[model samples]
Target: MERRLIHVITPGDHYSPRTGSAVPTVVHGLSAHAPAGTEPTVLVARGTYPDRYTSADVVEYLPGTEPGRWDRRLDPLRGALGVRRASSRPWAAALHDQDEWPPSVVVLHNAPQAVPLVDTTRHAVVLYAHNELLRTYSPREAALTLGGVTAVVCVSDFLAERTRRRLPPALRDRVAVVRNGVDGTVFRPGRRDASAPLEVTFVGRTIAAKGPDVLLEAVALMDRDDVHVTIVGSSGFSATDPLTPYERRVRAAAEGLRDRVTIRPFLPREAVADQLATTDVVVVPSVWPEPFALTVLEGMAAGAAVVASRIGGIPEAVADGGTLVPPGDPRALADALQVLADSPDRLAAEQDRARRRAAERPWSVVSAELDALLAARLDGQVTA
Candidate 1:
């Protein structure tokens, strides 16, 4: 029997202390829990920093432009132009050079242009959409890039629907929804001191879009000394990256809370897990339309009562595990936080619900679902 080689491509650099994006984290989890009999190898862009996680074999590819603020700003423009997407061609060629054996499955992450770059005639190609990136492609461009792709896996139902809407009707059936998962082993609940003040934490990029400021504003409105909030993260994944004006504004808001709030720079994955484990309440106050908030699931997995923005796929992720508040509304957030802080029993119940909910969606389940999808694709069977 032939070896089952699965090439999992990342959108950019893999998980490193300096790389703060969720894509690498998700990749690491999925690969770590991958199904038996399948070998998964991750392909990442060459970076100065070493990978933090070694769950799978990783190969480096030289991307046209490294992940940076300027590259992110120009993504829409690059996606609009079909020729510009050719930057991933080198990555495609490297696929063949990796080994003597060909990959049975090629999983492309986020980059639509790379879908057509793969030799679909030989390999079963799958496009994993971590964001609503498909909407940026023109109809013709979408059809061309996704023509021979076996499936388009979206991280959330919200993202799947968004992906379908952007594609031609004929190609929409190929879209599949596979929500992101959390690693319970690392993110499981830790000891929480009931005697201490309500521990509130906001984790993610500390930008206006992520609503770190909104969290600070909400905590300020409560005007209660019994609750403490910790804002963890930076403008980017690298601690060395200069703080943006938005980050500065968020810090300014935190300053008003004085002893009530503690602003910290971005930490590594393990540190993030540690931060989540200790918190009583985790707030995801994203002001923008978040496709899905990984922090929401992570917080829940850590046994923290979650209060998050109800916009986009967050409601889907939170479900019955958390309290939802209107995005960017400090008063609403304040009320939600105050309710939990006022009643210890209520807080404990929320925490229990969150942990239970997280247990039901472990990384193992996600890996099994994705494994079945890949198996079906290779067997010429279409999965919904």
Candidate 2:
């Protein structure tokens, strides 16, 4: 019997020093909970986690450009110029130098360009989607690539349904809804302060799509001493880029209650989990169709009541753990928070429910599910 390896080819920082993206976080969880004897190696692009500090884990760093070079917008360029998507070709060749041994399962996280390039004959290729399908690839092109894919594992059923609507109906069955899971040990529910004001939190990439501005407006509308806000993470258009006027507007929006709100860049996972643990309520006011709000689930796991946008896969992911508001509506968000803040009993009840919901999607269980799914799709059969 040959040893089977589970390779995770991602283009972001793994959970070593830090994690700023959802796919990396999910990938870290998958690697952490892989079944026994299933050797997991995360193949991430070079410079994705700059400074080159290696962690004691199953990570294989490959050649890649600087942080901003591998943007999804480059997908069209690769297709037009016949350039391969992933920069890990040299590394892959090195790993397969033996020629006889290949990774049994290759889960490509948000690397659409690697789909067609992957040799599906030797390895079971799982297309792990962390975002929308049409955003990077066209319907016909995406459907065509489905021929080589084993399973289109979407983070939420919402993403699965959205992708199915774009692809051929026959390929719909290949779509699977494996909702994102959290490390239960790291993100368990904690005691909340009953006397303190309702503490609200929003954590993600500090972009306009995440709706930090909308959350600010909703907090301003509350106009109460009892409402607190904390928005963490960064977006594009950094200090060097003059093209970002939206960030300027975001700074201006905080002028009204600067003292009441704490808006900072991304923090370490422990710091984030700590914030979620102490928080009374966590808000996800995404203006765009979010594939899945991992922050919402993490907040729920921390026993905090979550208030999020009802669009995309959030409603499905959230289930009964949180209250769903219309996307981009500050007034609706304000109303929901105010109602919860005034009623501690209701807040506590939701917290209990949220914790229970999170327990159902622990990383160990989710990882086992993924391992089973990928193993069954293998071209070569095996028995323990």
Clashing pairs in 2: none
- Candidate 1: which pairs clash? none
Output the number of the lDDT-best candidate.
1
TM-score of 2: 0.85
Off by over 4 Å in 2: 1-5, 15-17, 46-61, 64-100, 135-140, 236-244, 379-384
Work out the TM-score per prediction: 0.91, 0.85
Residues 53-91, model 1: lDDT tens digits: 777787765654434666656756776675555455445
Q: State the local distance difference test value for candidate 1.
A: 0.80
lDDT for each residue of candidate 2 in 65-87, tens digit (9 for 90 to 100):
43245644575666445554444
RMSD of each: 3.2, 3.8
